[model samples]
Target: MLTAVMQCVFRILPAVWVLLACLGGASAQDYEAGFKAFQAGNYAQARGIWRPLADAGDAQAQYGLGVMYERGAGAIAADLGRAAHWYARAVGQGHPSAQNNLGLMFAQGRGVQRAPVRATKLWQSAAEAGHLMAQYNLGLAYYRGEGLERDNKTALRWFRRAARSGLPDGQYAMGQMYRLGVVVAQDNAKALAWYRRAAAQGHGKAESLAQALADDGWEAAKLDVPATGDAKVEASPVVPKQQAVGRASPDGSVRSAERSSPAGSGTTGSGQGVRADAARIWLGSLRTRAKARQHWRDMLRRFPEALRGASPSYSEVDLGDNGTFYRVLAVGYPHPEAAGRACQTLRAREPSAFCKVMAGGN
Candidate 1:
């Protein structure tokens, strides 16, 4: 009889443990129950289920209550004041969603005073915590110069982060930037790639853009040129003129007559001891195509012998929010090895030449 009783008690223990979890949860049964009730349109049931936990300082419950008040779900009249109250409670506990929602409220002055600065601060806090919407909002803020200095670079960084996280809106924004060459150089192939990604997720604008690019018969191309046979080096080094300093572009890049000179840039380490294999060399990455072309002309004048047979050409690249730039390369080498030798020789000959081999193209 004693052995049988002990067996029954052991079996009963699991049931008792389950019952205990439903009340508060080592199983989190109540919170889940509230969510199900809310989804089922039983707003009252959800609110009732959440209130106790909310009063006991559960952040998720507080956020749920805030939503309920804001949306007026389940017979609860929409109350922005109450919503703000609950959101403030959740935000006090550092809830990211609550922070983002409250930021919206602050931005629109719904239940709070309109404050762009406040909204931005809240968005930044939530954004840094990896909240996708917050990241997107922050990107817009920077893009539009709202509550902060307009910084295309910062905006691009945030937009890239949000897009990489699979936000459809962010993906669409990236596609637009690519298509329009807002910051990066316009590349239809890349624009189509981004648009297609968004379209796969049912982004309407992206769908149309992707279709348009497809209609245009755009095809992806290799971004880099392959290495070729040894290049002939024939250009003689010449004296660089002081008057050949190129005009400053908006992004602060300047091309010198000697080429590859950025304003306030110091000489990179001399790789004289190391083998260099530069088939091509970089002159400067300038803001605009015209600026790059001007720099190339300056280079030709500055290094007549060094660029004897070289023609002016530039490669375009989009740096997202940092903006689009064109890299003007000075080339005529038999091969990269020759180019590398020339760059090394130039650097050795004139420390101010700032000669650097193109590591590779983008």
Candidate 2:
């Protein structure tokens, strides 16, 4: 009888273990289904599915139920009290998302007293756990000194982290910081680089900035007057009035001019230097255009799916000639080369009409 009893107990042990496993799996499935429903905007379904599991100690379910209660879903009236209770439960369980959500409640006094310091701690906790959006929001909090001390360096560091994590807002924010030289050395090249990176990821403002930079560069290149190849290199583009400084036209033709020698005439190449400076500036602008093209190409290659067949759009183009005037040109190509060829064709028709590919253009 003892042997038989032992055998039965051994046989039932596996069954008991299987039952426990099934229950655990069912609980997980329930939480996931509820979470999905909530994400899909089905609040009633979310509440109905999550309430039981939440009561049974599923942290995710608890958080979902808390949100539902706070929002008043599934015939459940809005109850900040209940929301706070469930949120506290999840938060106590070390759920980062729950902590972040609860922190917002405290920060805004929705279900608790307003406590900025406490809220900042919770947000930082979540942010430190690699919650990307939370990292971005924490970065903003630090940037604006809301619920925390204003620290531009800390803000920039967080923003960069989020940007590297592929958050568009973070990328755009980092680009703006670089552009404005806030808490870092001002670098137009770096600013443009960040903008290009963000714009490639479909950040509208970044795209506009990158396009503007490219347009400015292209116009500057067009205005540059290349000197004569045979002219002596005077260490710079400056040429003395007596020697004559050659200028190039948009038509690729060169012209030379002469002016009276300076009053002192002691090798005063200031006039020549001014012309050379203009030429250098123009060349520098063209290089900017090249950089812009490279930026666009890099962005396109990174997200081919985003740019595929997308309409090419251009905003205000500041060529820096007279005013910020945009040279509007219609492009009918999806690929960059096609648009470039089209621009060349337009140049053939109108020498001043230069084309630069804009993001989201077909």
Candidate 3:
């Protein structure tokens, strides 16, 4: 099923690549230096710089140190205990990457007690904080009911969130969901669009599926809904932002979600007469209704003065297959540009913040 396919895709990707890609933090210079040293086979030097910074409570340094310990790199012995230790320290500081890795360790029982529930909790925390990989992992967990209730609707919501954030795994999962008619209604056009998007990013199965669709005369441009527009703000390409360390099994195989069931039922419609010219800053998307409400409450608590008279709002989008998604929007903007500027201001504190202009119909 879908879960099996996801598991296979995870197995194909190298765990080391996920770790290396997720290495990021505010200490850009130090992290870059260490990364260069490690890349050049100067493990000892890399560790030397990272250890002292890690001791000083630098999250990035702690994460680097944890990686070193986990892999036995730079003269350090492979010590899962020490790896977990540093990871925990970083996680305490709300480090997204650390949360993801620590979740993996907990899931695999590496130096820590095996607790799928705890692992899922950690993934949820990181995913809500805008960690792409954690979002995908959390979706998988919900799909498999590994540590949480079996909720394909919730799983699909999480997957859509990750896909919207431009994660290839999420895009591939969405493609699978649409292709197989798993929670949402089967829409070959949407499936092909998602597959093509993922394939463009080098996802192997997505590439194969997209090619197969093409061979059958399917065209992505024929999809009913257009893909979301690219962000106007140009983020720095070199800096990794909120990266995710994927889940791994005891045998070192990475674990991912799959899909199996047939398409379910749901309504599909467009926004009513809401002004298409208006826009809002999208804080995040949540899989559950309760969580989305809680997120709005938290946003109010965090920015009381700015949101004193304003209230957070959300739109539920139905994606056939009994799947529904809640998009948490901070509305009250005159135009898309205004919302975009407001999003930039929000990003000063919430790095994952972005703006989404509302289209006319729902």
Candidate 4:
């Protein structure tokens, strides 16, 4: 009787494991379906799918519900109070975007009592967890001495981090900093380079600045002016120009640039030192070079530390009649476990950001 009972227990264990695995896959599929619905502008369907999952303690679904409530997307009415409630739940589960959004609400005193100090702390936490907007917001706080001591140097460091990650606002702010000689020495050339980068992303102010500098013949010989209809203009390295600087803008108004969303695609880094046979995380594929570049920039902004040593590379794949697609990849992960961990962190903030392990060269 003892041997028979032990055999039955062992037989049921494998079945239980299979059931659990199937449940996990089903959950992932449901989440993905909801995300696709959201992206397709079917917010009602997304909310319908996510509501149950969120109530059941799914962090990503909670974050999605928070966003829908905050934005009043689709059939939902805009409700900051409900947004805050869902955001609180998501952040408690370590959702990075939820933390950032809740921090913004606290900073602005929307649906919650005004608490700049608390807001700053939340932003700092999200920034450290690889939320790009939080990093930019924390940089702004440091620059303006909001809920923190004035520290222009520290502000510049954070701004540079965002700028290097290809954030247009950060690039523009860095240009303003260089132009005004705040913390760093005033350098017209460097300012122009940063502005050009920002302008490429459709920043209005940066476009005006770049055009003005070009028209004035200031460092004209050092710059490359793209002719009309050019497919691409390679930007030369930006070398800073030393000159006397002013302390403030002509209008004397506090210089603040609005935050811009990351582009759909962008590319960064060359797969130089990565071993050819190592595993890597495949991020996404885009139809255009511009979009590929935007995606790359977005990934860098969102995963700066995790991808510190990794390289961003792309390979073109031909799809007859549909044109070519650029496959974006983060190369240099030593194993699938490391890639999986980084993917989890990225997906916390960007639900649509896909990650899968692949051999380095493939």
Candidate 5:
């Protein structure tokens, strides 16, 4: 995710200095100093100049403070509390970038309580104010019914707003929705159009979807993606996986990987392990009708015939022993052996994709 603000100005000079001073004088001088420090990764010096201005209620400065807190720049530890504080301060003053950051933090519970409902509100506020990232996130929240009732029509509406704003996530999502007829009538041409737009922005998911559409005999134009400049965007932290107790790796690549971790207590997964965890998280998050449908659409971009446009039978199965809380998804297939095969393939690729099978009808 991109941070709220990145530019810097002179802390000693008054705000009006830029208006009176020559372009190559005070304004340029201050900017160059800060820019050099930022380029050299001297976030401390950059912050020294920016913090006072931010504290003095400069919207851009407030935004810069939010980014610094979020990224833990200038030798600061990552503190969600500080990040939220600065973001709220900037958003309150009508900074679009700050509004977008606040919405993202609310959605992910970075420095605030996890409230998809509140996140929906913030995203709506920002989207209405014409923030592009907010528009994309708002569309996603609506599509997923996150903190709000599911309304495909409204989701499509927000998606249109985001697409018009040239947000890649919105374009990718809209393409998927159009291809599957989730909110509107199914239209391959429209789906292809949106996919192309996102692919032009170098979105990986959109590129894959576009390729899938083209494989079905639809021709789409390739886009020339521009090289991104040296703007420093705040990076999200990676979520680590917890180890399951009492599990033994009998041998092979799995055992060697397990040996790397003392009892596999943390999320430091080897290359193979990371991919497996990603697959598990993806599968685990999809349980409700809406999520399942979205999962199906995503899968279609890769395995178009996997679901055959039919809903898969899914059930919750207990995985915990001694009253511990745990559940895994059991997806039914026409052939019992097919489900078994699917489980094996996923497990081979990602060891955590195991699920206890049940009767298919349920």
Candidate 6:
């Protein structure tokens, strides 16, 4: 079941590589047809279409075949050895998702020998590229000192990074930390918020905990800025009170919603939130959504009139291995013209600030 679920996170290739591939950076041979077939459950056709492409050195195809073999989805029976081979090929070509999945294989001693160090190294590579699962896994490794030195600070950083992107595992971890009052300050409000987010994403443990929290009278929370104690504890990632987690895609890819959100969808994070149309002025992508809040505050103080009618929210951009960034969007504009005018005014005032008019939705 774990292997099957990991298939949902199969393609974490870097955005630059995807861009390069689009701009003739790699072989132009089409492989999406195979993906379509797989999505349609035509495993035989997917295998047939992928074999030649995989053999011809198409990294994406190689990764697909690796996944197909791992799942025994095609005409061929389950072949862990072959799956590892294909994953290795894709990894050699800088496929971040393949690196992450293969790292799991190493960690579990499935196709390859158990090598926690190797697994951690692969996870580090993928995590650095913005693979949310990899980031979570690497954070766990850091928390445990698994094949690496234990660094709670580093672990917290990675966990927050993954959680900010709305990874269920990472969000759950955040909830646990807050609930336990371990690394972070104990804040039930923040814990409840994180739990609700993870629970909405179909995390079973989170669902159970969320129900418990609600029964205990906790509600969907605002940013619960906890007091800093001896240890400098920051608040959990801000998930707006209105954000609704997207349902999983029909294609069964866990990150599909995330993939589409950045292309002007106005949604935020991996699978978190409804498309917020009130958020019209896109302030450009920053490394974290936390930064979006800070940026918004900065803009409000610097140019109050320029942001005449705007709310606080963001559109998340998850770039597989390229990393995740949040586009700070100011909500409450009535139309494109109004939003455009606001952005234009802001631009006129601060020439370097990135401000784009993103129209609203229902």
Give each model's whole-structure lDDT.
0.56, 0.47, 0.60, 0.57, 0.46, 0.58
Which ten-residue region of model 1 has the weakest summed lDDT? 11-20
Q: Look at candidate 2 and give me any clashing residue pairs.
A: 311-360, 311-361, 312-360, 312-361, 312-362, 333-362
lDDT minimum window of 10 residues, candidate 4: 11-20
Give per-residue CA lDDT, model 6, range 1-362, as digits (tens).
42233223222211110111221333344565664455444778867887898898888788777766665653557687998899899999877767877887776677789787998898899888877667877876676666689776787788878777656567777777676665778787777777765543445677687778778876655544211110111112111111112222234222311111101122222322434354377654556667767877887786565575467786674422224556566886655555654553453234234455654751
lDDT of 3 by residue, 223-292 (tens): 4422322221112221122222444454335554221111111111133454533555555555556666
lDDT of 5 at 178: 71
Order of candidate numbers by TM-score, starting with the best:
3, 4, 6, 1, 5, 2
Q: What is the per-residue lDDT of model 2 for residues 124-220, given as tens digits with 9 covering 90 to 100? A: 8877876554566577667657677788789889888766655545666766676567787866656565665545433466778767766666221
Query: Judged by lDDT against the true structure, how good is candidate 3?
Result: 0.60
- Report per-prediction Cα RMSD to one decimal: 27.9, 28.0, 15.8, 20.6, 20.3, 13.9
Model 5 local distance difference test score? 0.46
The residue-level lDDT of candidate 5 at 273 comes to: 21
Candidate 1 overall lDDT versus native: 0.56
Cα displacement (Å) at residue 190, model 5? 1.7
In model 5, state the lDDT of residue 204: 60
List ranges where model 4 is wrong by over 4 Å. 1-24, 220-362
Question: Highest TM-score, which number?
Answer: 3
Candidate 1: misplaced stretches above 4 Å? Answer: 1-27, 220-362
Estimated TM-score per prediction? 0.53, 0.50, 0.59, 0.57, 0.52, 0.55
| lDDT by residue for model 1 (1-362), tens | 42222112110000000000122563257777876565445778878988998898888788778867765654678788988898889889887667777776776576788787887898898778876667767876676666788776787788777666555556666766666666778788876766655444345667787778878887533222110100111111221101111222333222221222211111222335443222466655566788778777876676554555555568875533234567677654545554554453344223234344554332
Best by lDDT: 3
- In candidate 2 the C-alpha lDDT for residue 75 amounts to 56
